[model samples]
Target: MINIEWKQPELILLDQTKLPTDIHYIRCTDWRQVAEAIKMLRVRGAPAIGVAAGYGLILAATEATQSNHPFSEQLSQFYEFAEELKETRPTAINLAWAVDRVLTLVKASISDNAITNGEALINLITKEAEEIHREDIALNHAMAKAGATLFEGQSNIRMLTHCNAGALATGGLGTALGVIRELHANGQLERVYADETRPLLQGARLTALELHEDGIPVTLQTDNMAAYAMQQGLIDAIIVGADRITTKGDVANKIGTYGLAVLAKHHNIPFYVAAPYSTFDFTLQDGKDIPIEMRMAEEVWNFHGIQTAPSDIGILNPAFDVTPHELVTAIITEQGVLKPDYEASIAELQSKVQK
Candidate 1:
């Protein structure tokens, strides 16, 4: 099921914060609501957030009128909207990448005098945002096929995944989950182990729900049980989606991904990261430079708004963590599976970069 949809005049989002129980959809007629949803985790996941941010820019553009301000002034307003949305989620590179993509395209069009007024500007942005949504769906499928090939000939393939990298998250089949779907479709999948990502439970609440709804056999386990499960030979491989990937192949994903990678290495299982081209951050040479967003302390100290620990307890709640390139088996992308020397593999990807 598609979690995010554009029904005109409103961007209908399947409120993820209320998942695994109520399938609620929140409508955003204004860009700020979309930005708030990203910040609130009401509409989350890297690709989903990127897709939402694109639509958010459209909403922001729709608010401006050529009669009220000059074209330059309207462009400035659009830039401000883009910056505000980008700030809502700092760890996910897709947020900034998608926003900058749309903005860059519109600016180039205007520079060539193709966009002469507010109406034209809005129309161009609408098409670009819609295209971003469509492209993400296609990328999901492409990456799935590329990633699934790695597990070919291995029947009853058992897989482990963290966070919510399913249709609900990616606006398409998924990244890691898409690969799982492909395996299931090929009659090769035995079972999937999903980690119940803490402080948010995106895996338990979102991944489990999606996999169950799709009739895929899924076994939910707490984040701490991952190593035990691996030691018991309950997991064959670890696959996850990335928030940001650096040029060195270091991955920034959900907070617990690094630990899982370490466990997978010990178990001699493949540790794969699935992501789209847009998720790559070319500016950062190393994952250490990738800014990790520190979340509110209450996210770790409380459960559903009820205090689960001392009220004054100190908490270091980082939303994401980095997995060094040495632990990664390969980086799955739409073009193909990237194997080390990532510099060489990523060269092919960098060739396709526009920005």
Candidate 2:
């Protein structure tokens, strides 16, 4: 299921905000519509956000070409557009990573005097954006197989996952869900327990639906039931996708991830976070420094406008929470699995990228 697609001149997104039941799609011929889709969670997930952002820039380029604007002015517009899309999601490092990826090519072209027209800029950026989309899918496949190796020799594996980290959350199979698919394919996994993530129910609404649609066995449960499930020894391992990972290996993921990691430690279950290297912010030293996105009070206040609480109730809904590296058993990547002493492991990963 290609959650995000670029059909040249326009960006089409699977409107995840209305998923499972509706199965709707949104077509954005303009960059602002794409940005709005991102802010509204009509298109979401870290990897998906990055991919969508790339296409958003492509859409901006398309519009710029039609406006008869000079190349210099259009390039400046692209820089401005990149910042606007990046600002749509503060927590996900990939949003900026992806947007900058295209801009780097554009910048390089400018330095070489290789591009003088808007059409040339469009060609360069569109190619890079398409490649980003392809690379994301390949990364998902590689990390899925790499992460699944950790559960080798185990049979009838029961895994617990939070939020929506499946295909709906990524450009391809998924990050965490990609590994789950591999395990299922190898006949090692028996079931997945999806947390009904509060405020949005991304788990129940997206993850569960995505898994079920893929023919994987999934059990939907409320967020609060996770502890009891762990106590009953129903969960074998926990794997999730990250929004941002610091060089120290602290992961910022869905708001409930920190509590799940704590539960995994108490039960001595191996906790895993599956993400591509692009999710890592080498600049940031710790998760505490990672910006957490504070969502609307209306989300916590009601169920899609149907009030569940008193009018004007005090609410603090943080979109993400930081999970310390110590709680994580391993960080799975396309290069390989990263073990503890994560600062050093991350340095090694960075070196490979630099090479």
User: lDDT, candidate 2, residue 84?
Assistant: 82
- Number of the predicted model whose lDDT against the real structure is largest: 2
Give candidate 1 misplaced runs (Cα > 4 Å).
353-355
| Residues 136-212 of candidate 1: C-alpha lDDT, one tens digit per residue | 99999999999988987899888999998888878789999999998899899999999999989999999999899
State TM-scores per candidate.
Answer: 0.98, 0.98
- Candidate 2 wrongly placed segments (more than 4 Å): none
RMSD of 2: 1.0
Clashing residue pairs for model 2 = none
Pairs clashing in candidate 1?
none
Predicted candidate 2 versus true structure: per-residue lDDT over 172-214, tens digit per residue: 9999999999999999999999999998999999999989988
